[model samples]
Target: MHRHSDAEPDWDSLRERIIGLGEHSIHKSYYPELQDRLAELERFRALLDQTSDAIFLIDAETGLLIDTNESAWLQLGYNRERLMRIPFCNLIAPASLAWFLEFFASGQNRARREQVTVAGLMTADGCEVPVEITIRFVTFGDERYAVAVARDISERIRTERELRIKESAFESSTNGILIADLEGLLIYANPALLRMFDYEGVHRIQEKSITDLFSCADTDTRLLARLYREGAFAGEGHGRRNGGSVFDVHLSGSIVRNDSGQPLCIVGICMDITERKQMEELKREAYEQLRKNIEQFAILGDHIRNPLQVIVGIAEMIDDPLTAKILNQSERINDIITELDRGWVESESVRRYLKRRERPEASFAKIFRNQNNPE
Candidate 1:
């Protein structure tokens, strides 16, 4: 063995060099730098795992899955090794596989640089998970890769379906429906509303103020005020059509609010009451005519009775042979007059019955008038 120096070699510096930590050590190693890089990779992976989105890296040429994030394997219920062994197309639901293949084969994804699509991703348990996928093509040295970021959209799909159903209901409803901004400008008018107002299309009515649809000058003002104060309003009012013709309508409206309970817009429903109003008017006229007829019948009966009385007095004053015949005929005429009086009484009874029947309707009308006039 060679003789050692009197001073011992620096043990601490030697130890640091052995572990890849010291400078100017002939025995230096890269272990510490390698550890730092490994730690950075672990942190990046942890970040990807924490996200709700599944990320996949695929070989563009072979369509094989090269790597994936934790969400990808966890969401698909597959182990990392098995998921990497499977082809990317195998992960897509059968219904979406053909389109996905065509999308890649046709170079559409590369041409677009980035493309977004909604499809189903098959799970390990034979179930399908709806996903909205955004794909981008990239290259690294000699390898072309596809970067796919898929977000589970089951809730979004369900919400969209519900919205479609509501839209259908709004379109198919019989009652006219309208949506307006807080400024009273019409934004949406359903088919029924367009037809009710004799408009051919929604464009004919959109952006028009609600006041333009009502014959009452103050209708929109009062309606907005009530909606602001009470959040709702309901009553009967007159509507103006495209041709300036007016008709009755029962209007119900309320403020539409958002999740924060802040008013976003206004919604209104309109029911045409023109026919009902016409029928009520006709009934009122018929009742008035019947009342007049009853009065005329009573007056006619009284006139006939007075004439008969005069004839009876003249017959009683005379003693000629024709007087008995006149008295007998007069008695017959009196009997006929009595029959007329009986009919007059029956007519009066009928008039009273009709009046009683009309009382409730009259009271309702009175109430409505009071509401409108407010005296």
Candidate 2:
């Protein structure tokens, strides 16, 4: 029971003031922190919306869409409110619906926690859009949901189809086609290449150096060097078969390059030219025989004329009746020689024309000139 003075402060009032200050401080600090959390949530939502992949959160038990990202509504050409009202299963195209229903109903997705599938999604225009969907089961609090991330795969499918067409063309070509690495090791040989080399299978030719197929020891190196310098090569060479037999081949090759012009591999096309080479050899032989015949005709005409001239000179000097008959015979013989000479000239003209048409290497002009000059 202490006595109170007017100057003494009120204990109850001070306690009330202290409590009010604490409450005010708490309110001031709490609001800013709350605002920061809300801002962070907004940024996260924006990030999810920015991605190209369509993301959806579905109610696992009801098979209904709980929520979806911006891409989902945009891709399906639906407003957010309308898309949210639709069941997730309704979005799948008819062709893929059965598989999806089985996948969900079998409880396999729950057991695996994650699954991947390719399915078509129905668009607003009733067109099916191919998508690669990755589904993951997750729990938030007591609610179970399926998180699906879908990526469009139309471009990938198109590219695969084009690749198949190109492969088919390569397989069906008549000329031999081969692909080799930068080191000149064979990697792929088409069917025609295998048959041309008399190989039972592609495995026989694969891993073998490209030079092994050619009789020339330096063909591979030369061709590779040329490809690096000029980007292409084309020429004729002898090809060695599996049984060690050789045949003529015309090979055309180029460096397979990337879009950036960097060399990736080598591609070659080969043609068997054995028949053409044989034809050329036959022509050369025929021309050689023709040249010999022409030479013999010219020589025979000269030999016969020399004797005929001597006989004519002796008959003219004798001045007898038999001499006059001999002269007449000589005239006949001279006419025959002139006709033979004309024939030789005609044959020589024909020979010249044929020589112009033949290859430069097949020329026999020097041989004929040497034989005639006897130098």
Candidate 3:
């Protein structure tokens, strides 16, 4: 099928007919059509004026802005009449203008199609405003014009910068950081987290569930409920590393939610506390040993004191010089026994005091040394 050329229509006959009707139809149809066309132009102007984005219609051949929306004047801090003569490059930054000119001179291939880019737009006050611009080429009558839309994206740029900083902090942190989806499967893990779990790479851990990280029974269920309800959960847990080795871990986690308050993911940090847990167990064992030693000393002291008391009583009954000597010797022996008993009591008291005060290591050492040296 052959497509017809878009040629101008023949309006001479129509005009002649209107004149032959004694100008009556001129007021009826011609004036009304003119009014309708004018009204349509007014509507188009309103659409451009009401839009929030700055719009500029530029001459493609000369690169001069021929028309602009009201927002363009407000956004660029320029008067409506003065901006009509402003070249499009005047709105671009000095440094950016060079590249803009180079690209524009490369013909309208890129401009003919829809394109979006980010650039700095020079404001009237000489300061630059970063804007996201979209441009397209269009033809009106016999002339070509580039229609450009520019939007201020300061807030978007600021948010993206903050996101980059946060991501850097997360990546460089020493503590293990991991993020898991609502289903509890791992989505992301930092280097620290991968090392903590003894995994060579994050790919090995992804698609794994939180249950794989813990040795405690029912940890996933309990933690999930707590995190979703309270939005945070923190405490000690048995974290299983690679090769099935279970180690003590202090896990801190919180729930992440979307704007609508729906659960999105869980973010958590983990620290290995295996050495600290081992130290506590050792201290407990030492404390128990110290208590047993004190009890044994008390028992031995009781048995020895009873025997010494009997000897003292027998010696007191004698009256001769030899017997007096025996009494004196027996009294000396009793005095020595009393000192031993006192020493034992003093050591036991010191052990009890230290232990009660939570100095288990000190109490254990003191008791052990006293038993060996009897002081």
Best of the two (2, 3) by TM-score: 2
lDDT of 3 by residue, 166-252 (tens): 999999999999999987789999998899899999899999888789665634565666566668766777788888888888777
lDDT of 1 by residue, 76-123 (tens): 999999999999999999988888888777654447767799999999
lDDT (0 to 1) per candidate: 0.84, 0.83, 0.78
Q: Can you tell me which runs of candidate 3 are displaced by over 4 Å?
A: 1-23, 108-114, 293-375
Query: Where is model 1 more than 4 Å wrong at Cα?
Result: 1-36, 106-113, 218-220, 290-375
Supply every candidate's count of residue pairs whose N, Cα or C atoms clash at under 3 angstroms.
0, 0, 0
Candidates sorted by lDDT, best first: 1, 2, 3
Specify the poorest-scoring 10-residue window by lDDT in model 3: 359-368
Regarding lDDT, does 2 or 3 come out ahead? 2
